[model samples]
Target chain A: MIAFGILAIVALIGGIGVIVARQPVHSALFLIVNIVALAIFYIILSAEFLAAAQVIVYAGAIMVLFLFVVTLLTAGKDDEEAGEELSGQRITAGVLAILAGGGLAVVGVLYPSQRIQLGLPQNFGNLRGMGDVLWGPDFVYLAAVALMLLTAAVGIMVLNRPPRKKADPEARLKERES
Target chain B: MMLLQVVLLVIKIVLLIAILMGGFAYTMLLERRLLGFFQLRLGPNRVGPGGFLQPIADGLKMVLKEDLMPDGADRFVYRLAPVIALFTALSVDAVIPFGAAIHIFGLTVYLDIANPSIGLLIAFAFSSLGVYGLVLGGWASQNKYSLLGGIRASAQIISYELAMGLAVMGVIMTTGTANLYKIVLYQQHHGWLWLPQIGAFIIYFITGIAETNRTPFDLPEAESELVAGYHTEYSGMRFASYYIAEYINMITVSGIAVTLFFGGWLGPWLPPIIWFFIKVAIFLFVFIWIRATLPRFRYDRLMNFGWKFLLPAALIYFLGTAVFVSGVL
Candidate 1:
């Protein structure tokens, strides 16, 4: 429980740091912290598989790419430039955030207590359990997600495909003359 | 009882770190000596018998050297990078069982630190995280070479990691487990996996070399091109940390290879722990041998080899393994 509290505090600080950090690279690092903390939270809940996946996919793979792009694009850039190009945007965002928070609070109070479960099955998040869930009755949902990812991958390949070279007109004319 | 368990855990961690660090030192000496032999040279034979004390000398020299931080560097991350590198490198060993459990003083002690159900995945996760150190170190150095090195390291690691993961999936499928100890036990009953999964083992070894940023794929720190790569701006102990991390990462990769494909710690007559070390040493020798034999890959060719050749081969091998394991063909 104490560990959980500490992790919660760390995650909160990381969330704040992502927004407060001036540099893009620093923001990415903070996001890693946040993701890692959540991964540990999954471990605390006995979801070792999820925890590992969380770290591997989120903190390890995705964040490395995030940092890569940020460094490439924003390296050595200063963050002090501020133009009031979108005046009152911050105020509107803050107002919407407050309203959303209030709405969530109201929902929390009004929602039936029965919706929340107090106990979990043993090894409920282990590989065996996860495999059963993913490959058994919920296999259709898993297939759908896999297909979506495949589509995205094919799209990337298409976008990166090089333009086909056109035959040279002068070469053709020279060959015809010969 | 809880106190006793905690004490045991702490003892295990200390011992593990001590052994791994010591292994790192000697692995460096071993590489130097082997490389020298391969290149027809004497190789550091002055200190102690056959240069056995060379690693100690190297450690002292590293500690005594002046630590330098490049001007205009990011102070915080520059300091943080090596720590991240070494930490992740060492943490991967926690789940690798060194041998069968031993009975001592009315208590049973497991040879490994932690044997979580997702031990294999944990190793993958920590290794993936290892890239942060190189990338951050390069980016923080305020050197174009370092930044480029970091970028190359990330791209190379990410590309090869997919092939490595797919290759290991063959072993996991055959054994039906991710726990290292259990995998070894399965091997004891079913024989070593290398013969059955030879194709995957070959692919795994190749990708493992790339993942560790070793020769033929050591483009990240290709000194000829990048001026020592990501740690170009690092000096003294910080540089030593990166060095130590790389060697230890080599050991971790070899250790995993042993556990997965070579029937870890299973040998006739010899003790299990000794068997584990012997297998690991063999893998380490191959690593150095490859380093001495192959020239570093050109950048574009390295990426092409990883993405085009290794990835497809791993996928095909994995599919075959799955079919066999499931008895579908």
Candidate 2:
């Protein structure tokens, strides 16, 4: 219980820091901390596979990508002032966040009797259990996810391809030679 | 009883940390001496007893030297980066079983720190987190070379990590467990998985080299290209943290290789701990040998090899092992 409380505090602070941090790199770091805290929550719940997957997939791969892009673009510099030209954007985001928080609080208050039990089964979140769900009835969903990722990769490749010109093949060859 | 257990746990952790620190120090001395031999030069022989005490001397030097931070650097993150690196490097050892549980004073003491159900994944996860140190250090230095080095390290790590993870999946499929000790036990019963999973072993070793940022994949700290790479501005003990982290990571990878493929602590006519150390030493020697022999890979070529070759090969090997294990092949 103490562990849970500590992780909760960490997660909450990380979430707030993600928005409050000045540098993009710091924000990404905060996001990583939040993800890691959530992973610890999974571990505390005995969802060991989920916890590991969360770290490997989310905090490891995805967050590395996030850090790469952030560093590439910003170089850890806070170039733009907070809420300078995005005053309305900030207000809209604030209002949406408040609405979501309130809605979740209301639902929790209304459904107090509908709270799920915390105890999980013997192999509830192990790899075998996850594989059964992913490869059994939900195989189509898995395939769909793979297909979607493949399509996105292809789309990015296409978008990134250099433009081709019909004229001056000899000139192009000479340019390359030079 | 609970207090006793807690005390045992603390003792185990302290012992492990002490052993690991000593191991890291010696491993550095060994590498330097070996590299000197490879290059036909005497390496740090002026230190006590044929440079046996060189690491101690090096540590003293590092501690006494000035710690410098660039004027424009982010002071906080600059300090935090090496801490993160070293922490992740050391923490991965929590899941690695050095030997089987032994009877001591009527209590069965497990050799490892933690034996989590998802041990292999935990190791990989912590290793993957090591990139943050390089990236943060480079970026926080506020130098162009550092930034480039950091970005390169991050990219290389990400690419190689996919291959490494997939390669390990092949072994996990055969063992039917992610627990390191269980994997070792399975190897003992079914013979070494490396015989059948040779491809995965090769891929794992290659990626392990890339993951640890050693030559020929040491582009992150490629001295000729980027001046000290991501650690360009670092000095003294702060720099030593990153250095120690790298060596510890090399040791961790060697431990993983031993656990996953070579049958951890399963040898004839020797104590389990001795067997484990022997295997790890062999792997460490191989790492240094490769560093001595191979020229560094070009940045683009390294990326290509990781993504184009290693990733696909690892994936196919993983799928093949999975299919075979499931009796679908």
Candidate 3:
């Protein structure tokens, strides 16, 4: 319990540190740090898979994309300037930000278990145990989920990566030649 | 156990975030060093001890840098895209576990955030949202190139992410759980999935690179072609945020490879944490090595690879492994 309290404190500190940091990159860096720590916290609660997925997917791939875009161009440190009034868009953005905050707040309030709890290792960090519990009786549900995953894998690939990059001239020529 | 769990989770978030942001700073240094090494030129050596303070200097420069918005741009979405991209990227860390728990003061500290059994799915969900950043950023920029870049990126990420998911599905089907830690443990019990699942891992790695817009798959930011891609109009620290986010994402993908294929933190002769880092580092090096070695695939070839080559192969591998595993089990 004492350790979780400390982790919560650290996450809060890191959260605040992100905004307080002078450099935009530093802020992003702080945010990334805060996230990784949060994943570790998830693990302490026996959510072992969550922690690994968090680090593996979130902390790893997405951030790399962000950096790739950021550095491919001019990266300066002067992003702290306030935006101009520029009509009601500013108000809209503020409203949207507030709405997001409100949503998080609502979720937080509703999910009290998500809050600081006493030793919360509902199960040990073992997938085999989870499988035994979740799939032992729920094999049908497991198969359903697997099917869903298969569909998601296929759907996203097809609908998104359409073969249109060469609809212009060269592709047509190659097609005709072939 | 439940009482102490919450307490321990709180501590882990703090440390993990600190480590990630800290690592982000250092990763900048590492990339610069590697870039200079590749270019056969000395990089920044003026900052703290061997340019180690370079990130610090860069940080100082960012706050002092200018923030500009182009005229006739969608002000709201433009700014919002970077924030969303950054947030989504950072959020993935919510699922990764670093080490075993230590029991102290009746509180056993967990080493991750949400150990959701479906954490692997959650990670992909966040990544799906990440493309919105590029799409929004490009659309908001109100420029043709930026818009095109955004279009390409959205298409690019959505495509590659699918292949990546299919590739990962191979692992989940074989291991029989979407839980990443279990996947790692599964590797430990069985041999490294990489040995048998080499095809899935390759496709996953390639798709991940494309998803992250790394070189040989970086048409979104193709300097000669797309200007600066989605952020052609961004300047100063807002721009810096994108840069930092990319390197961090690089680390993220590398971490995935470490976890999914390299038996994260399960190597002999080292503690789990050390093993995890070593594995992640090797993959990180691969990222740069690929950059230095391969030429960017033409846009059509990239799409073909995803659709013709990757998709079918991933599907076959996934189903084949599932049947094989189900029969064996």
Candidate 4:
């Protein structure tokens, strides 16, 4: 319980830091900390597979992508002077952030009244159980997810394709002049 | 009884760390000597008998050397990077089984630190976390070369990780478990999964090399191009931390390879621990040999190879294994 409490607090602070941090890279680092805290929470809940997946997928692969993009674009130059031009916009964001935090706290307080047990079965978080869920009755859902990911990949490829020579006005004009 | 168990656990942890540190030291010496012979030269033989105490000398030098940090570098993250690297590298060993549990003096002792049910996934997760160290170090250094190196490392790791994970799926499918101990036992009964999962094994080994950023995939640290890459600005013990992390990661990869494909600790006549070390040593030797033999790959070519060839091949092998294991083949 103490571990859970500590993790929860750290995750909460990390979540706040993600939005509050001026530098994009720092924000991404905060997100990583938040993700790691969540993974620990998964472990404490006996969802060992989920915890590992959380680290591998979210904290490892996805966050690497996030940090790469952040570093490539900004390179840690997003200081306070360059951030948020309008005061009204900042005020609105602050109000929304507070609302979201309060809403989450209210949900947490009310969740236990629903009598939903968080305790999982002995095998529920094991690889066997995860495989059964993925490949058994929910096979169609898994297939759908795979199909969606494939479509997204194809979309990226199409978006990234080199422009046709004929489609380039400068090239067409040069060809005509030649 | 509980106190005895705790004591045993403490002992195991200490022994594992000591052995791993010693292993890392000797592995460095072996690599230097082997690389020297491969290139027709004698390597570092003056420290101790046949350079046996070379790592100790190297460690002392690193400690005595001045710690140099680039001006305008992010000091906190710069310092944290090597710690993150070494931590992830060492912690992944928790899931790897060196051998089966043995009974000693009316007590049971497992060979590894912790054998979680999702041991395979945990190992992958921890290994994957090592990328953060490279990326953060590069970014923190405030150098263009370091930043580029970090970016390259992250991209390479992310690309190859998919192939690596898919390759492991084949073994997991065959064994029907993700636990390393269970997988090893299954391999013993089934005469090693490598025969049936040859394609997966090959892909796994290649991806393992790429994951650890060895030669051919060492574009991140391509000395000719990036001037020692992301670690160019680091010095002294901080530099040594990254060096130690890389070697430890090499060992961890070899251990995983042995456990998954080579049948962990399961040879005849010899003890299981000895067999395990022999297997890991062979893999480590192969790692060094590949580094000596192969030239570094171009960044674009490396990315293309990983995504185009390795990923698809691993996917095909994974699906094939799944189908065969399900008795539909």
DockQ metric, candidate 3 = 0.05
**Candidate 4 overall lDDT versus native:** 0.91
Inter-residue clash pairs, candidate 1:
none
Model 3: CAPRI class: incorrect
* Fnat across every predicted model, in order: 0.64, 0.71, 0.02, 0.78
Candidate 2: give the clashing pairs: none
| lDDT, candidates in the order shown | 0.92, 0.92, 0.76, 0.91
lDDT of 3 by residue, A34-152 (tens): 87789879767767665656655665556545544543332322455656658798689889999999999998789876556556444654556565756779888989999999999
Off by over 4 Å in 2: A79-83, A95-113, A164-178
Candidate 3 positional error at B5, Å: 5.1
| Number of colliding residue pairs in each model | 0, 0, 75, 0
Candidate 2 lDDT, tens digit per residue, B1-329?
89999999899899888988999999999999999999999988988899988999899999999999998898889999999999999999989999989998998888998998789999988988999999999999999899999999999999999999899989888988999999999988999878899999999999999999999999999999998899999999989999999999999999999999999999999999999999999999999999999999998899889999999999998888888999986
Q: Tell me how far the alpha carbon of residue B70 in candidate 2 is from the true structure, in angstroms, after superposition.
A: 0.9
Per-residue CA lDDT of candidate 4, range B1-329, in tens? 98988888888888888888888999999999999999999999999799999999999999999999988788778999989999999999988899878998987788998988879999999999999999999999989999999999999999999999999999988898889999999988988878898999999999999999999799888999999888989999999989999999999999999999989989999999999999999999999999999999988899899999999999998988888999996
Candidate 4, residue B209: Cα displacement in angstroms equals 0.8
Per residue, candidate 3 scores C-alpha lDDT tens digits across B56-163 of: 888888878889898877576678878877877777777776655446787655566876677677777666667767766776677778877886786678668767
DockQ (Cα-based) per candidate?
0.69, 0.71, 0.05, 0.72
* Positional deviation of residue B189's Cα in model 1 after best superposition, in angstroms: 0.6
- Report the C-alpha lDDT of model 1 over B1-329, residue by residue, as the tens digit: 89999999999999999999999999999999999999999899899999999999998999999999988788899999999999999999999999988899989999999999879999999989999999999999989889999999999999999999999999988999999899999999999999999999999999999988999899999999999999998989999999999999999999999999998889999999999999999999999999999999999999999999999999999999898999988
Instruction: Output the lDDT of residue B42, model 1.
Output: 82
